[model samples]
Target chain A: MKEIWTITRRELQAYFDSLMAYILLILFLGFSGFFTWIYGSDIFFVKQANLQVFFSIAYWTLFFFIPALTMRLLSEENRSGTIELLLTKPISEWQVIVAKFLAALLLIVAALALTTPYYITVSSLGNIDNGAVFSGYLALILVSGMYIAIGLFTSSITNNQIVAYLLALSIGIFFQIIFQMLSSNLTGIAGGVTDYLSINSHFESMTRGVIDSRDLIYFLSVIVLGLVFSESMLMKKRSV
Target chain B: MDIVIENMTKTYGRQKAVDNISLQVKTGEILGFLGPNGAGKTTTMKAITSFLIPDSGKIFIGNISVNDNPQEAKKNIGYLPENNPLYEDMPVIDYLQFCARIEGIAKDKINDKVREVIQTCGISREKHKKISELSKGYKQRVGLAQALIHDPEVLILDEPTTGLDPNQIIEIRELIKKIGKEKTVILSSHILAEVEATCDRIVIIKKGKIVADGTVEELRSQAQGNETLKVTIEDGGLDEIFKALQLLNTVELVDFVDKSTQTFQVKSKPGQSSRRDVFNLCVEKGWTLTQLTFIETRLEDIFYELTLDN
Candidate 1:
């Protein structure tokens, strides 16, 4: 556990040590704010009491941002041959994977925290659905974790960060929309299966001011599967 | 603790990167691993450090089996890999501290340990700079420092002196010798002279197999090559002596050394005393021999003979 945290700390420090963290934060906030407040069909246009515009815009922004953030977590280490130095230490592959995952999660949390003024401004304007707002943020956290996991897994697959990012985005597209697309077009058992598996279905349920154990399990399962896949890739590298 | 390996082998696809090979390094001995490119030197080192899992056999570090207990085995080893990859964005001190942390040193002792390692590696002046900003030699020193931060019993340094200038190489060599005084050191290099200068015992591997293992003198004595003799006769009537010298089958090649002194280099078959035969011939020919010297067969000849065999 100590080793894991130490790795996490270093990984997090690396993000801030370079211009990547600042650039990512600025881009995320800029795009999300522009779409939610300054662009067409924003909160003012909808005249809604909650932050559905912000959540919707932020979710899409995070979809692209998380991969860029997580791309370097393992890929850079592999490219620089630091992974050899890291694995030779007294730490397991799983510990390294978990540490990388936690570091990306922490960065997402920081980005979310920076958007607090949006919540404050919306609440001050009119009556808002506090329950729905909390659930929305929580759902964002879960979705961020899912994308980060996929990014990490892709990063472990190759030493190229761009390839990792693209791979993560490609794999994530299936969960983000393909499943939803199939769910709407298919019927009966196939439709039900796709709807149950689609990340949007679970994300949608949480954004409506309700938390379900089933939705939590679905998100947690994807997280576990992605992390486990990343760990397996590392093990293969160690063997190779 | 000493390291032990038995029949360790690692294969990539159909090619065997590390063939079934076994060797041991006794405690407090500096073992130089000499090999050409793609000779499985790095693969074997990686196996010992637990960076790569061998396909078969086992590595034991101080009686701890690396295959069964890799983390524990890794704790006892400080490996400086071939390229010495480091976090370029990280400053020297932070990198050392990170190494110390992963090495399992106490949190409070990390500072002291990093300081001690910096002193040992002679990187104190550049400790404040980022790794990428430092010179190549300084970066190499940082690599050594990280390996020594935990003071592990075993140190596996691959190409430790590579990319360093002559002065820096000597400095690093002396440092390795000092470190090897108390720790078992296994260093790999293509430079035979450096290995001869620093290592107590030298092992040459080729194509994933141990071809030679012994001291410098032992390996040199085993080398089957021609002996070179620098012979200098009086400047007068040197052609007659040169002619008679080349008559003997033992003298393979003869070349002029100096026109003023009539110095001519002569080569003789292995285990044959060219001086005795040449002296008798000089006396018979009435040629006054001013100088007769023997050049020892070098490690280069031995390394080539052992590794370049078809």
Candidate 2:
């Protein structure tokens, strides 16, 4: 646990030192503000209190930004040969994986937090349900967590940062889009399973102003599966 | 504080990176691992440090089996890889402190320990600067400082002096010698002269196998012979020098190293010194010898002779 925290602290410090956190925050705020105030406002033609615009825009933004943030978590270490130094320390494989995941998760959470002004603007402009907004943010966190896990897993398989980024984006898009399409094409039990596998379905359910236990389980399972695969890859490399 | 490696092997796909190799390092002893490129030197070092596990073998670090409990076994090791990967954005002191934290050093002692290692590695002056801003020698020192921050019983360094100037290389060699007096050190290098100058014993690996293991004297004796003689004569023609030194029956081979200065390296029979014969030959030829010196067979000959067969 101590070792995990040490790694986490270093990783977080790296994000801040490189100005990555600041850039991510600015990008998140700029996009969310443009979508909500400029496009979704009454003056722009699309007037809706549904917040569907915010969710859709935020989700799409993360499809590219999350991979950019996490593509170097493990891949850069391997390319620069720091993985050997880290492995030589007195820490377990799981500790390293969890530490890196937690660090990336925290960065995404901070970026999400920057969207608070958007919520405030929506509230001041008209009547808004605080509970629904809170639930929406919660769903976004879960979705971001799932995306970060996929990015980490992709980063573990290769040392090239560009390859890691592209692979993560492809996998995230597959889970978010293809699974939903497959669910519509199939019927009965097969369709139900496909819908359950679709990340968008679970996230969409949570953003509808209700917290479902099933959606929480789906996101948590994705997180665990991604971390488990990452740990196994590291172990296999070490044992070679 | 002994490391015992028995029949260690590691394969990458169909290629065996580390073949069945075994060796031992006693307490407070420096063992230089000498090998050419792709000779499995780095692979074996990684196995000892538990960064890479062997396919089939047992590595015991102070009686602790690394395969069974790698984390526990690794606590006793401090490894410095060839290309030391440091966080370029962080200051040197901060990086060492981070290393101390991962090693589980107490918070109160971390500061003093980091400082101590920085001083030991001769990087105290550059500790305040970011690693990216430091020179290559300074960066190497930072790597060495981190390796020593935890004060592990075993230190494994792979090509510690790979890209450094002559002065920096000498400084690092002296530092390694000083540190080896108190800790078990295993350093790998292709530079045979550096290994000969710093290590107490050597293990030469070639083509993923141990070709020779012994002290410098033993390796030299096992090679052709331990005796060598160097004679530098005044400016003379090569044909005259060759004719002058070729008359001795005891001289096995007279090698002319340079023609301008007429320097010749004469190899005598095994266990025999050719200084007396060369002196007599010089006297008979009426050659005015400007300089005559005896040279011992160094590790380079042994390394080349052993690896040449492969």
Candidate 3:
């Protein structure tokens, strides 16, 4: 646990040092804040004190941002050959993968935290669904975690950061919208399976103040599977 | 701690990176690993550090089997891999601290450990600078510092001084020798002189297999099985000296080296010395023996002979 935290702290420091975290924060807050308050179907247009606009905007923003943040997590190490130095240390491959996941997740959480004033402003404006806002943030975090895991897996498979980013997006598209679109066009068991596989079904339910165990299971399983695959890819360096 | 490898083999596809190699490095020994490129020196070191798992066979670091408990075994090893890769964006101090933390040094002690390592590696003045900002010599120092942060019992450095100035190379070599006093150090280098200067034992590999293992003198004697001498006789004719030298019991063959200078090259019988015999023959014949130099086989010849293809 301490080893994971140490590595996570270094990775977080790297993000800030490289100015990636600050740029990501500004862009995320700018896009999400702009669309949620002043743009189409914004809060004033809806004439409601709810943050559904912010939550929806954040969902799409995070999907794009998380991969960018995670693209260099393992790829840079692989490119610079630092992975050899890192793996020779006392920590296991799983710990390194988990540490990278936590670092990106923490940065995402920081970005989400910066928008708390949105909640404050909405609550001050009128009656706000506090429970919905909390669940909405939870949904965004779960989605970010899932995408970060996929990004890490892609980074592990290649030493090129751009390749990692593109591969992650290609894989993430299915969970974000392709599966949902496929489900709508198909029928019967196939449609049902696609519907379950789509992230929107779970994310939308959570955004509406619902936290089912099944939804949590879906998000957690994807995160775990992605991390496991990344760890295996790292281990492949030894034998292959 | 002592390191023991038993018939370790690692293969990449059909090519065996390490082929049934076994070695033992005792505590307080500096074993120099010498080999041609792609001869499995790095692979063997990686296996010892628990970075590369062998296809078959076992490695034990003080009785801790690397395959069975790699994390435990890795704690006792400090490896400077080929090219000495590091986080170039991190400052020297921060990188060392990161290494110290990963090494599980206590929080309060981390700073002290980093400082000590920086001092030991002679990078104290540039500790605040980013690794990428440092020169190649300083960068190499940072690599050594991170490895020595935990003061592990075993140190595996692959080509530790590849791109350094001569002064820096000597400094690094001296530092390694100082550290090897209480630790098992395995350093790989293509520079024969550096290995001869620092290492206690040398292991030369070819085609993923160990071909030679011993001290400098041992390898020299092994290759220098027959004694050779270059003798210059002042008074006698070259042919007469050659024939007279050949008549000595210990002399195997004699050939004129330079007829104008009356110099002859003499080869002694296996495991025999002809210097004394040649001197007595010159004395009896009243011929002046101006120069009689023993020709020793060099390490380069031995390495070339062992590593070159048959």
Candidate 4:
């Protein structure tokens, strides 16, 4: 745990020490605010105090934002050759992976926390279901976690950050939108499998203001699978 | 701690980066690993440091297997890998502290330990600056400082002085020498003179195999298996010296070099000197001997002879 914290602390500091973090935070909040209030569906236009517009906009904003934030986690280290320096320490590969995951997750949480004013504004406007608002944020965190893991795995596979970003985005799109589209349009087992594979269906369920075990299991399973694949990719580098 | 490796080999798609090789470095020994550009020096160092796994070999640091319990073995080693990759965004002090923490140094002693290494590596002034803001020499010092903060029993440095100016190289070499008095150091360098001056023993590799291993003089003798001597004679005719040089049984070949000097390349039998016979011959011929110097086969010559063809 000490070793993992050592890595995590340094990585977290690195994120704040650079301009990337500030840029990401601004872009995430700016896009979320713009899409939710001005362009997509304003509270006045919807005639309700619900934050569904913000949550809906966040889904797309997070897709690009999470990948940008995570694409450099391992890929930059590999490109700069610091991965070798880091891995050769007494710490294990699993520890490095876990530390990086926690660091990126913390940054994402901070970004999400900054969006709290939107919820406060919605509450001030009219009566709003607090449970649904809480669930909406919870669903955002789960989906963001899933995407971050996928980004980390793709980052581990390649040393180029741009390549990692594109690869992760491509794979994430399959689960984010393609599967959702296919599942709704197709029928029978194919549609059922696509629906099960798509993360949006699970996220949609969570956004309905109730927590379900199946949706939680689905997100958790994706997180575990992504982390496991990332760990295996890093371990394979040791042999080759 | 002592490091022992046996039958270590690592291959990449049929190309062996580190072929079967065995070596041992006792405690407090400085082993200079010398090789050509692609001779697998980095690969071997990585395998020993637990950064890479060997295909068919075993590495033990203080009797703990590097292939098995790497965490325990890694605690004994501090490696400054080639290119000295560091977090450019981090301050030198923070980077060292990070390394000390990862190396499991006690929290209470982290500050003092970082101080000691910063002083030892002569990077105290640069400690507060970001790594990317420092010059190459100070960057290298930060690299060394990071490796030393834990005070590990073994230190592995790959091309530690590759890019430094003359003064910085000497400084780092002096630092390594001071540290080598207490720790086992395995450093690879293309600078033969630096290695010859600093390392107590050298292991020269070519094509992923060790071609030469010994002290400077021992390896020199092993390279040519004979000695060449340059004789500068004054007040003596070249023809007289040439004719008289053949009379000595120890003198193998005498070639006229210039007006009065001639180079006598000789192969002495074990534990014998051809100069003794040459001195006597000069005395007998009433010739004046101005200078006599042996042409020692340098590490550069041996490195080229071993690595040039392949």
In TM-score terms, which candidate is top? 3
Query: Which ranges of candidate 1 are over 4 A from the true structure?
Result: B224-228, B235-286
Q: How much does each candidate deviate from the true structure in C-alpha RMSD?
A: 2.6, 3.5, 1.4, 1.8
Total backbone collisions for each predicted model: 0, 0, 0, 0
Alpha carbon lDDT at A110, candidate 2 = 83
Task: Put down candidate 3 lDDT per residue, B212-300, tens digits, no spaces.
Answer: 99999999999889999999998877677778888999999898888898988899999889999999999999999899999989889
Per-residue lDDT of A1-240 in model 3, one digit per residue for the tens?
A: 999999999999999999999999999999999999888989999898888889899999988988999999999999999999999999999999999999999999999999999999999999998899999999999999999999999999999999999999999999999999999999999999999999999999898899999999999999999999999999988777
TM-score of each: 0.93, 0.89, 0.97, 0.96
- Report model 4's TM-score to 2 decimal places: 0.96
> Native contacts recovered by candidate 3, as a share?
0.95
List the candidate 2 regions with Cα displacement exceeding 4 Å.
Answer: A41-53, A117-131, B226-295
- Best-to-worst order by lDDT is 3, 1, 4, 2
TM-score of 3: 0.97
Model 3: CAPRI class? high
- For model 4, state the Cα shift of residue B56 in Å: 0.7
CAPRI category for model 2? medium
Ranking by TM-score: 3, 4, 1, 2
Clashes of 4: 0
